[model samples]
Target: MRIELVKGVNLNIIPSKQFKTTRIFISFIKSIESKKELAERALLANYLEMCSQNYPTQIDIARKLSQMYGASFGSSVDRRGNYQLINFSIDYIESKYLVGNEDLLSGVIEFLKEIIFNPLKVGENKNFDEETFTRQKNNTIT
Candidate 1:
């Protein structure tokens, strides 16, 4: 079932007894202003998907997800006509499939919130982690 939570936001619920995993996707859509903006937005998406204020490194984020039964986290940028979409997604095994009952949904939601709202930053400049930003930028350019 899919419901419109707001004017532009939606909630989708898919209950399946056949599958052992759950998946969540949160996406942002906007018009592309320029080539530079597109590149920057792509880099930003990569940086946020990889690290957050709580999980400041790739290893930290990976370990945290591993603790949650190997949940997968990622982001991607896509072009739809003249618009650009940035999507952040997570897929994880349900608690029913794990050894113990765990609230993986709550943890995943909290981590996603942190990634979207509290990205890893560097000093008072309010910029992303320098090395990460540079690396993502280079990756985007290539």
Candidate 2:
């Protein structure tokens, strides 16, 4: 095959559909020694997506998103194209939709900070939050 490469573009917009922007969505690829570790890692990784220090719990996070004209927020895991992926997404109506969204941009950024920075890990040394980790583990199977 001929050597070829192409550059990709990042697009930003403030359109009618969404005044808020996509926080982040990228895949991760790494080796897992065993099936169990794969399961465990996936669990912890997902829990971070659930909430953050600011949000603290799933329901509180959900409520905030809901207040933003039914904005949607959450995360998911996938194994595809030889990579293990954790995807986080937040969607909210534009500030004009409600006319009082002074923090829409910052809120989106804070949520992204939580997702990429917080990940599933466990132990006494301050890893994943145990309660959230366990809940994610149980829920992942279904």
Return the top candidate by lDDT. 1
Q: Where is model 1 poorest over a 10-residue stretch in terms of lDDT? A: 2-11
Can you write out model 2's per-residue Cα lDDT over 25-138, one digit (the tens) per residue? 434556566778677667766777776666677787777777655767766767765556666666765555456655575566555665566554446786767788677778
Q: After superposition, how far is residue 15 of candidate 1 from its true place, in Å?
A: 2.8
Error of 1 at 78 (Å): 0.5
Model 2 ranges with Cα > 4 A deviation: 1-26, 29-34, 100-103, 119-124
* Model 1 pairs in collision: none
- Shift in Å, residue 75, candidate 1: 0.5
Candidate 1, 8-126: lDDT as tens digits: 66647576788788888878898998988888889889989878889999999999989888899899999898899999888988888777776687787777778887899879987
In model 1, the Cα lDDT at residue 105 comes to: 75
Q: Which residue window of length 10 is worst by lDDT in model 2? A: 1-10
Per-model CA lDDT versus the true structure: 0.83, 0.61
